[model samples]
Target chain A: GIQVEQSPPDLILQEGANSTLRCNFSDSVNNLQWFHQNPWGQLINLFYIPSGTKQNGRLSATTVATERYSLLYISSSQTTDSGVYFCAALEGSNYKLTFGKGTLLTVNP
Target chain B: SAVISQKPSRDICQRGTSLTIQCQVDSQVTMMFWYRQQPGQSLTLIATANQGSEATYESGFVIDKFPISRPNLTFSTLTVSNMSPEDSSIYLCSVRTGRGNTIYFGEGSWLTVV
Candidate 1:
C-alpha cells in the first residue's frame, strides 16, 4: 500500500489569485489522479496524470513519477474553484487507490 | 469515459438496519472499487469487486461488515450491514475507464445511522 500526503491542508485565496497544491507519495505508482470534491460532494476528476503534465482550462497538473510527487496548479482562480482537491495514487498492479487527506481551497470573491 | 449512476443518493437509517447501494456504469469494466469517506476524512478503499469472483476487502474492512457483489461487468452493489453511527459515511463506487485507465467515481451515497 502506498501513502499519500497532500500539503497546505487548508488554503484561502481571493478570486483571480494563483496557487499550487502538492501531493507526495511513498512509493512508485502506475496511476495518479487529481480530483475536486465540490461543495455538493460530487467528486470530479480533474486529471489522470501518472507522469508529465496536463492542462484543462484553468487547471493544470504535473506528476514527476520518478520523484514520487505531483503538483496541481490553479491559474486565475475563481469562486467556483472553492472545494477540496484530492490526489490519489495506485501502486504497482493494485486496483485500489490510496488517497491523500486533500488540500481544502477556499477561493473567496 | 464511463458514466456511473449510484442509487439512493442519500439515506437515513436506524441502528441495526442495513442498506444496499447500487452502482451502474454505462460501459463495461473489469474491476469496480468501493470507497468510504468518513466525516471530514479522506476516502479509503473498502474492497475491490471483480466479476465472477469474490471481492477482496482491504485491511480494517471485512466482507461481513461491507459485503460487495459484482454480478456483471457494468454493475455492482455494496451493502452496509448491521449499520451503526460509526458506519455512517459517504459510500462511492468507482472504475477505471478509457485508454488512460482513468478512474471515475459516482456522486456517492450519503448514509446516516441513528
Candidate 2:
C-alpha cells in the first residue's frame, strides 16, 4: 500500500484570500484525486489529476507524478470552502485508494 | 463521470443489529469500492467489489462483518452485520468511470450505533 501525506494540517483564511495545499505520496500512482468534504459531510470531487495541471473555476490543481507530489490552489476563497480537503491516490493495478489525513480549511468573512 | 445514488442517507441502530446499504450507479463499471470515514478520521478503504466475483477486503475488515454483493455491473450492496458501537461511521460507495479514470462517490450513508 502507498502512503499519502498532506501538509498544513490546519488553515484559516479570510474571504477572498488565496491558499495552496500540498499532497505528497510515497510511491508512483496511476490515479490521483482531490476532494472537499463540506460541512454536511458531502465528498465533492475537486480534481482527478494524475499528471500535469487542471483548473476548475477558482480552484486549480497540479500533479507532478514523477516526483510523487501534487498541489491544489484555491483562489478567492469563500466561506463555503470551509471544510476538509483530502488527497487520495491509487498505485499500479490496485483498485483501492490511499487517502491523506486531509487539511482542514476555515474561511472567515 | 457517473451518477451514484445511495439509499438511507442516514440511520440510527442499536448494537448487535444489522443494516444494508445499497449503491446504484448510472453506468456500468467493472469495479466498485466501499469506504469508511470514522468520526474525525480520514477515509479508509473497506473492500473492493468486482462484478461476478467476491469482494476483496482490507486488512482490518472481514467478509463476515461487512459482507458485500456485486450482483451486476451497475449495482452493489454492503451489509454491516452484527454491528457494534465501534462500527458507527459514514460508509461511502465509489467507482471509477471510463472517463479518464475519474472516481465518483455517493452521498454516503451515515450510521450511528447506540
Task: Score each candidate by Cα lDDT.
Answer: 0.93, 0.93
Clashing pairs in 1: none
Candidate 1 lDDT at B68 equals 91
Docking class of 1: high
Candidate 2: misplaced stretches above 4 Å?
A: none
What does the lDDT come to for candidate 1? Answer: 0.93
Interface RMSD, candidates in the order listed: 0.7, 0.9
- What value does the lDDT take at residue A6 in candidate 2? 99
